[model samples]
Target: MDEVQVVVAHSERATLRVGDVFLKVDADQARIDIEVEAMALAPVPTPEVLWRKPPVLAIAAVPGTTLGRLGGPSTGSPAAWAAAGAAIRKLHDAPLPRLSGRAGRDVDALAVELDAECEVLVASGLLPAELVTRNRQVAEAALRPWAPAFTHGDLQIAHVFVDGDEVTGVIDWSEAGRGDALYDLATFTLGHEEHLDDVLAGYGSDADVDPEVIHAWWSLRSLLAVRWLTEHGFDPFLPGCEVDVLRSRM
Candidate 1:
């Protein structure tokens, strides 16, 4: 019998692994539609879709370790990071998928959410008001218009998989859609800024991206995730973790 591994479980969705297959269960049918569509449109490697049955989608596991973890050092070589970068570049360069989910997310709306979350962080006394304020100000740089691309809306380090120097697959596509290109880059390197250079090197010089915007996203994402992580029974405040990321920006 294959052991069932709980990859992730939250109020909104859950992912389970059994043997070589992954079962993603989501209550939102729209999100599943977007994931299936985005995976088909992506030019880079994504997990093979085995089947879909309404609330559950089954996919064959890609044979490779994740590129890195959120609060830890990446064991991936610079080349692997570069390959992942190249893969992102390919995805960003592809035609934008027509999806109502998270595509064309409003920057003003993001700023509003950031502000609300920062208030929660401060009122809870979980983080210093000064730290939250500074990051919030830094996040202002990302609150501008951007040319939409096929962004992996949540491109965390753990979502990218690699074998040796080759990127085998990218997972967790529920947030995939047309959005800001820099958002993807920032999400990929959040808390792992040290590897940004190698990733950018592989991404090449075609993109005219602003470095400040990328930095802003780091602050914004950390601030937003910290509260949700805490609520979901994951401690983002641990040392060398999401809270640490917010502090590092100070």
Candidate 2:
């Protein structure tokens, strides 16, 4: 019998690993629907669906290890990171999906939400006012208009898998949809600023990505994430994590 391994668990969803299969248990069927549909439409490689039983959706694990975690060092070489960037570029250039992705939220709406979160962070003393304010100012650069692209939405470093400079697959399609391509880039490179050049090199010069905008997104994402992460029992304050990312901007 294969030992069950807990991948991640929280109030909303949980993922468990048993041998080569991963079981994702999510309460919201709509999210599950989105994940299934997104994977089918994505041009990039995704996990193979093994089975689906309501809240429990089983998928075959993709080959290769992830790029890295937020607060951890990445073992992938520059070529591997570049390969992941190329994969992302392919996904962004693909035809848009019907569903709006997590990154597809309206700019005005996102700004309002960001402001509210910032206030909460300050009032609750969760973060220093100067830190929140500085990052908020920096985050403003990302609020401007951008053409929509098929985005991974939550393109965390851990979501991209590579095998020796070749992208094997990308996982977690729940937030995949049409949105700003830079958001995905920023999310992937967040807290790993040293690798930004390598990633961009593979993303291509034709990508028209703005480094300042990507930096803004780093601040915006970190500020907005702190509260939710705390509520969910996640520590965003870990060294080289969200708080560190914010501080670096100052």
Cα lDDT, all candidates: 0.89, 0.92
TM-score of 1: 0.96
Maximum-lDDT candidate: 2
Worst 10 residues of 1 by lDDT: 99-108
Off by over 4 Å in 2: 100-103
Candidate 2 shows a clash count of 0
Best by TM-score: 2
lDDT over C-alpha atoms for residue 95 of model 2 = 93
Candidate 1: tens digits of C-alpha lDDT, residues 37-97: 8788789899899999999999999978987788886788999999988999989988888
Q: After superposition, how far is residue 238 of candidate 2 from its true place, in Å?
A: 0.8
How many steric overlaps are in each model, in order?
0, 0
lDDT of 2 by residue, 139-204 (tens): 999999899998988999999988899999889989878889999999999999999999998999
Deviation in angstroms for 24 in model 2? 0.4
